[model samples]
Target: MIKIALFNHKGGVGKTTLTVNIADALADLEKSVLIVDADPQCNITSFYMDESRLEELLGESGEDGSDATVWSALKPVVEGRGDVGSITPWEMRKGIHLLPGDVLMSDYEEELPTAWTECFARRQRGYSVTTALSRLVNNNAESLEVDVVLYDVGPNVGALNRVVILDCDLFITPVAADLFSLRALSTVGRSVAKWIADWQTIRSLASPADRESIFEGLPTYGGYITSAFKVHTGRSAANPHADWEKKIAPRVRDRVVSVLGAVNPDLIPNFGGNKVGGVKHFHSLAPEAQKYGFAIGKLRGYVNPGHYATVDDARSTFAALAREIVRRAGI
Candidate 1:
């Protein structure tokens, strides 16, 4: 399976939305997809399930000691009980499944920084802790036999995101046309470059057996996607956010693509440019889709003439984006 992470250091750039919609689009293309909600916020979990069902799944362990949430799977490692355990992902639709997120997953963050430092010493436990999520994901993906795994991570450059990013095969950043999002590219770029270098150093220090405990290498930089930009009409044919989009593109190239390319040119994909695809603002349609737990393309029994064009537009945009992602990842 191809493991791809939707990540960005800047928050509110539509990472969760992109992840769900893209997974939906991929499923429409007949690919079995598994979405790992690595974010402690559990936004995607809420999006996929109702409150009662979500509470039941994430509340506590069952009589058989089974808990389907991500935290429960990693609880053993976080609490020093043992390595990561298996999780039962919730099937959302025909071809889409979700490994639901947990607020308790934030507890795992405390162990990561210490584990990272110990990695240079080749400590077995250190490697185990750092690779917990990756191992959990790989095991589940294999069991589910999915074609792709999309990880939805939080917006940060902390130890948690570091380990998650290292575990991915490739990562795509979802950016908004704004200054904060633009500046966040630099932080994302520098942090990822350092993580790759540090991981390489750890690998070099490891024995063959130690190397077998973790992913072979860090994730490649899959291109960025512009998201949540408003599409203006009426008085002017041009989008008001066009200028910001223009600014974001070159900055992503300079800050992300170039910086990581310097570390290892192989880290960058040769096919897609720095800007992979974009999703325009969903406006009122966003809440409607979210309320019904559907992708914009899959909304049912809708007859709003006003939203007809927007729905059609969303369907095509996400479909094209999903295809581009599959092609770039060589899946």
Candidate 2:
């Protein structure tokens, strides 16, 4: 299965939105998709599920009967109970499943950092901690039979992302048209490079059996989705904020080329060449879709009257973006 992470080191870049809609779009095309919400904020999980259910599954008292969150599977390894347990994915739709995220996932961040260092010391627990997510996915792959696994990570270059990104086969960054995002492109490139190099350094010292489960080659930069842009032309494309696109797109390409080109030059050939799709400001449609608890692609007519145009734009843009990402990632 192809694993893709919807990531950006900067928040408010529509990473969660892209993750949800892309899963919907891919599922519409009959691809079995699994969205693993790795973000501790659990925004994707909150989007799919109601607050009451979240409280029940991951409450303050932690008294839930079901353990469906990704953290549940990892708790076994983290607490030295056992290996990673089988994951129970909640089916969001016919062909789409969610390995929901939990707020408590933040608690494991410290343990993961400790494990990262201890792994090189030949501690079995350290290696297990590093490979927990991969093991969880592999444990469920046969039953899930998923075609694609999508990851949603919070905006940080923390230990959590260090583990998740290692398991990813390709990464699709959701970027906003802003100066901050332009600067963030460089940070993301550098962070990913360091993570890969450090992991490889550790892997070089691992035993044959440990190496089998310790590392999956780092994911390559697949492409980018430009989101949250002000559409001055409003789909007319006469003069749609040319300066924002002109500034950010080329810089994004350069950052990726400079960071990853030495290893995977073919992933991004030139400026704007790796841009998969552009999503303009999806303002009202975003809340509307969230209110309905479904993807905008699945929104229907007459229910949300007078917003048919907005729904159409949301559906078409996300569908096209998903298609382009899948094609570019060669899934």
Tell me the whole-model lDDT of each prediction, alpha carbons only: 0.86, 0.78
Quote each prediction's TM-score.
Answer: 0.94, 0.91
Q: What would the per-residue lDDT of candidate 1 be over residues 199-226, giving only the tens digit for each residue? A: 9999999999888777876689888999
Best by lDDT: 1
Candidate 2 lDDT over 37-122, as tens digits, reads 88999999999998898777675223232366887777777778788765568888899988888887786676899998987787
Best by TM-score: 1
Model 1 bad stretches (over 4 Å): 61-64, 229-240
State the number of backbone clashes in model 1. 0
Error of 1 at 240 (Å): 4.1
Q: After superposition, how far is residue 232 of candidate 2 from its true place, in Å?
A: 13
